[model samples]
Target: MQAKEIREVSCVGAGVIGYSWALYFAMKDLSVTVYDINEESLQLAKKRIHESLETLIKNNVLTKEKSEELEKSIIYTLSMEEAVRNAQLIVESGPENYDIKRQMVEEMEKYTSIETIIVSSTSGLLITEICKNAKHPERFIGAHPYNPPHLIPLVEITKGDKTSEVVVEVAKEFYTLIGKEPIVLKKEALGFICNRIQMALYREVCDLVTRGVCTIEDADKAVTYGPGLRWGIMGPSLVFQLGGGQYGIAGALKHMGPSANMWLADMADFKKIPDEFAMIAQEGVNEELKNRSAEIGNDNASLAEYRDKMLIELLKLHHKL
Candidate 1:
């Protein structure tokens, strides 16, 4: 069945990611049943959803009345059977452990219809490994959303070895219909796309600070005030294409390839965070947020609000909203 025909979606696990998925589906006018074993977590999920909906309304993404209506569309339940009974799509955001995910998939298979499309919100785990014990692995896929899934537009839809092309397409269409920018991966790889690129940049950032080349604050400013500004407008590849002048990417590479190769060779190759660097990183982040936390109260929440607000405006400018 086509994604547009799917009216009910079940979100397993009421953690932040699952709750955000529930909220997004509800906001798009789909019936969402969120299942979690913990009542307290469910309550917290409800609270966050309410708070995020208010933020969305404030940002003009939704009317107050519409937000209220959407809030009602989400149903919280502790029973997995009840959650998946009528669901056409199941989004599982349980623990990231392979064994836990494997067990969850196996249990969910017992409750869901054979046609139900199951997807995981795993960051780095392979979908094939997660669905190894599934009765029907072809119905399973990976639908990794960035943190705050409701706000982030990108959802990476990846396939397992046994995941059918039709299921992948349907998953992509489903996410797209719910107002996400869904990119399908040809094959499963660790960290998918964004996270891999994100970690690569993070590694270099840590390397710079660890080497005393610059403070964390300076590194942040360098990105935010420099390439980051253009990055928000276009990806690095396209930016380089523009840098190529009339010759585009090829010309830009020809001019800068030697210097780029030299820098690449000198990049850090550490697989884990060094102990000394970890201390420096922690201290730097704390120092950066100290004043901002005092001013805004609840540093994380305030920063998230600020992020969502800016994202709404940026998405609007990009015609993504």
Candidate 2:
């Protein structure tokens, strides 16, 4: 079915990610049903959704009345049958266990229509493995969204070995309709794109700290005040192209290729974390948190609010909002 033909979307597992997905669909005026087994989790998801809507209103992204109307479009339920009933799309954000996700797909297939597209929010697990037990594996695909799906625009649409090309296109259209930048992977890979890049950078950061090259706070400051700013505007390849001065990427590669290759060869290549490194990493994080706690008061909710606000303003500057 075309994305425009999809009116109802089901969100299985109403945690932070699932709830954010539901909120995004609701804001787009699509009907959303969120299903969770735990009553407390459902309540918490409702509360977070309300708070998120208020944040959007305060940021001038939506009017209060419109936000209220959108909120009403989301229906919370415990019954899997009710959740998938009439749902054109189902986004699964349950636990990350392979067995659990496979089982969930098997169960969802029993109720959902044969044509309904089911996507998983898994960060690293292979979509082909996750859908192995699916009744209609052709209808299964991976739609991994970055955290806070309501705010983030990038959604990685990955295909399993058995996923149909038509299903991938439909999923891409669906995410685009809901105001997301959907990137389709030609082939499936663990961690998709964003997380893979994230881990590459994180690995270097950890290595640097372990070697006493810089403190965690200093490393963070370097990112926030340096390349991170440029990365926010454009990707590294483009940045390198510009860094080439009048010659562009060709000249830059010719001049720096040897040094870059040397650095790459010398970079950390550890397959497993050492116990000492783990302890140091934990201590460094604690120290950084303690330092920030003095000024931020250690309230996670407040920190998250601050983060979302900053992200919204950045999006606005980039003409994304």
Candidate 3:
């Protein structure tokens, strides 16, 4: 019954996502080997991980000795075989090119054992298509993490048509054991689950900006001060359920439907604006970042700190619950 067999983790690309993955795995006390073809990029990746660990330590998120131990737990390698040979979980973070993904997965399958789970950190590529040419398509699945994965908790676990359900369950257990929140999708789509939801909200925000109903700053404030806080505690469904009171969604809809329709209408008008919304949106984003850069950075730092502590607390509470 112990299909939660992940022990060593290997990341094939030592870029931002790869480096972040290495940090997450190593922080979980699993040995991680990160591979990159270019030696300079590999070194930079290692440096970035160390720097982040240092930040964690300085912020009291991780103790100095603990950070050192985690740094020692990770190894950087150029040889793909050496990186993945003993790894039970291998994350492919290469560029989003079909040919490259095919070649890498093919080469990886040649060396990785049958039990090893191949996870794609791809953002857009379909899971089924990526494994179309993989030798062990049964073992290949999508374990897409949010940006700056070391800090974010959500890992969207998706499977292709050929992927085995057992593999998905095992991946979920492995992620849970490593202190991540895994949301499993019953089917695979273009953006999977999280990204699709993210883009839907993003499109609306874009439209809101184009229509001049609110400035770019107003849109972000709408989220950070509203759903963002609630979403931090619970997902959208649960949060809305709580907002619904005892009558559930039906009751809430009766009261809120008119406002929702108005908001949707305003959002729809955004699509009619000439593509000039692109420049406005970009400018708005940049301006918001510039204005809140320092505050946002500090907030992120504190949030990461709180996340680590909260995960520990929740794990302890889970037994009692």
Candidate 4:
């Protein structure tokens, strides 16, 4: 199906990701139906949907009136049939477990046509495995959105072994139409794109803290005040192109490679997280939180508010909000 033909969206599993997807689709003026297992879950999803839009409203991304109007576009349901009835796009934000996801598609296929595009919100599970038993695997693909989908623009799209190229293109176009930045993987990779890069950096942070090279607070400050700042505006390669001055990325690499290679050689190489660092990182974050002002948030809820506010301002600069 064409992107323009995807006028109705079905969000299965009404957790944070699912509801946020519903909110974004609805905000873009698409009709969205959210399905969950029970009233309590759907109710929680509704509350979260409201609160997320309120964040957008507070950041001037949406007026209160407009947000209310957008809320009208979303409907919550417990019935799977009701959810997928008229949906051209089914965004399954269920569990990350392969078996559960596999089962979800089995039930979903009973209700949806082969023409309906099914996109799993699995973080790292291969879509090929997830859809192997499906009646219509060709329409299935993986679309992983960064947290708080209404605010974040990154959605990594991965194709299943049998997934149609047309399905991939239609999904990409639909996400772009709703103002999301979608990247498609040519070949399946563990953790997709952003997660690998994020985890790689995080591994170094953990390594530095464990080795007593720096405190968690200092590492965070370094990133927030350093490359993270430039990265928000432009990607690292583009930033390095400017950093190279008279030269480009190739020049920057030439001048910076020796020391970078040294640092890389010394960086973390472990596959799993170091066990002791969990408490170490938490303690450091708690200590870091103590230093923050109330206006910038000293706790989880307030910090989220602070993050969404800043994110909206940044989105505005990019002409996205």
Point out the higher-scoring one by TM-score: 1 or 3: 1
Over 7-124, each residue of candidate 4 has an lDDT whose tens digit, in order, gives 9999999898998999988888898999998999999999999988888887778899999998876888889999997889999999789888988899899998778999999999
How do these models rank on TM-score, best leading? 4, 1, 2, 3
For model 3, state the Cα shift of residue 225 in Å: 1.8
Span of 10 residues, lowest total lDDT, candidate 1: 290-299
- Model-by-model lDDT, in order? 0.89, 0.88, 0.80, 0.91
**Model 4 segments more than 4 A misplaced:** none
Choose the strongest candidate by TM-score: 4
lDDT of 4: 0.91
TM-score of candidate 1 against the unseen true structure? 0.95
lDDT of 3 by residue, 156-274 (tens): 98888899888888889888887778999876677888877777888878767766778888898999889987776678878767778997767777778999988777555433435
For all predictions, the C-alpha RMSD in Å is: 1.8, 2.0, 3.9, 1.0
Model 2 RMSD, rounded to 1 decimal: 2.0
lDDT score of residue 144 within candidate 4: 95
